[model samples]
Target: MDIRFLVTFMEVAQTRHFGKAAENLYLTQSAVSARIKQLEEYFNAALFVRNRNSLQLTAAGEKLLPFASSLADTLEQARATMNEESIQYLSIASTSNAWDMYLKHKLDEVKGHLDHVSIRAEICSHEQLSRMVHEHSIDLALTTLPFKSDDVEILELSDSMLSLYCSVGIIEEALEHFNISIDWGQKTNEALEKIYPEIKKASMRTGSLQVALNYLSTHNSAIILPAQIAKELVNAGKLHEVDSLSPLTVKCYLIYLKQSKDARLKKFIEVFKGMIENQQGR
Candidate 1:
């Protein structure tokens, strides 16, 4: 049977009025009636029993509602797969670690691999990251902890080693440098407290690692930063590592839709892996 017939049947069953269904489907009422009549004739059974005041689905129509709904869903999925649109859209949310180290170095790689997409990045907490993914507001994320979502696919990018760092000038008078939570959240604050139980006083509560870096640069304060970020700064003679805690490694992951089949996304993953491997070798 024609798909139009099933569509008309479903719409009529839902609205229970030929005129309303026709208006919804952008068809003439006569056209809608004809399609339903054709469907009934094809099935050799009545699909709807219409009276002067009301329309009721016949047994056949009642039985076919679920199947019709399934067909519509399948068609929607097929349309998404077969559309001729360019894959130029991607939304990403990440933790502070990603912004500090990997993103700047991988800009050229991202442009080269994902030529079609214009990247937009948001730095958010782990909980905000999870909510964005769950609500389908964000397409992907780079974070220390992978989101606990069955609908998301996570790929481990690299293990970030944490190290205390400070401005070059402050390295000499290290007593002025101290580490605090990247933000005011209890989780980050507690983590910092546990690491340094004796140092009850924090110089400041910065909003993000990026902000902390800026503060460290200007105020000559110290903070724990990812080893990759610290090493890059030290190499450029911008900052130096402080000696409070040794390097502590935490895994970073890239997360995306479980069913994402975009070629650009695939190419980006491959190029990113190569960049990470090259970094490791260096």
Candidate 2:
């Protein structure tokens, strides 16, 4: 039961590509294959369904993923605990879109409240964020997707509104040509469809809010973005809201382990909540 094998397994599961996983782990592709084979032999199950130009996790692999992630997280935490300098380290995980929309600025404000703690924030997918929290790899997570885990405590943060926006001089043709679609979530998608039923296609579709912003800045593009951001850009005369349409709202949630004993983690959560409250009050 080598921990390295579990690490390898998790990497392969994430990438679903032996060469990609090996490159990330700095191992040869053959070495990655060997580790996966050994892990499969140990479990007496095939972890992956390999096909031409495709790879997917088998049922056993799906079952092992969470446990392997948890085990790897535990090992990492133990190592960090053994290192005296890492005692004050605090890790937070969130999607890049979430970070751009609110968490980035809020984190800056919170950092002032945490005098001695070292912060490590990562941008990852919602699924990855949940896995990290469950595995204890991250102390806290700010996400739109809530996790259904007894070991985790979820707090409703706030509703983020998304409104359609475009540059002032863009015509309908240009707007359609440079339209950017952002994946807020399933609920937002449904709302968007109801609001803009005729917009069957867009020039670009992305999950990254930052990318959407960049495209809007460089092109005469129209996009649905966080209301706060849209307002700021509008004030700057860079963007204007599509007043003909209504805004869509999405709820954001903060998650942390219920069993966490770290004082810094608790304090950061308090600071974050207070900041949100103060913002809403204004």
TM-score each candidate: 0.58, 0.66
* CA-lDDT, candidates in order: 0.71, 0.78
Per residue, candidate 1 scores C-alpha lDDT tens digits across 1-282 of 767568888999989999898777755576688788888888899998989999999999898889988988888786687555654666778877665556656666667767667778888888888766643457677877666667677887777666667677777765555645464345545665687653356666665667777666667666666677677688999877765354455567887766556675676667667877886899
lDDT of 2 by residue, 185-206 (tens): 7777877877775444877788
Per lDDT, the best of the predicted structures is: 2
Candidate 2 lDDT at 214 equals 85
Q: After superposition on all CA atoms, how large is the RMSD of candidate 1?
A: 12.4
Question: What is residue 272's positional error in candidate 1, in angstroms?
Answer: 3.5
All models, RMSD in angstroms: 12.4, 10.5
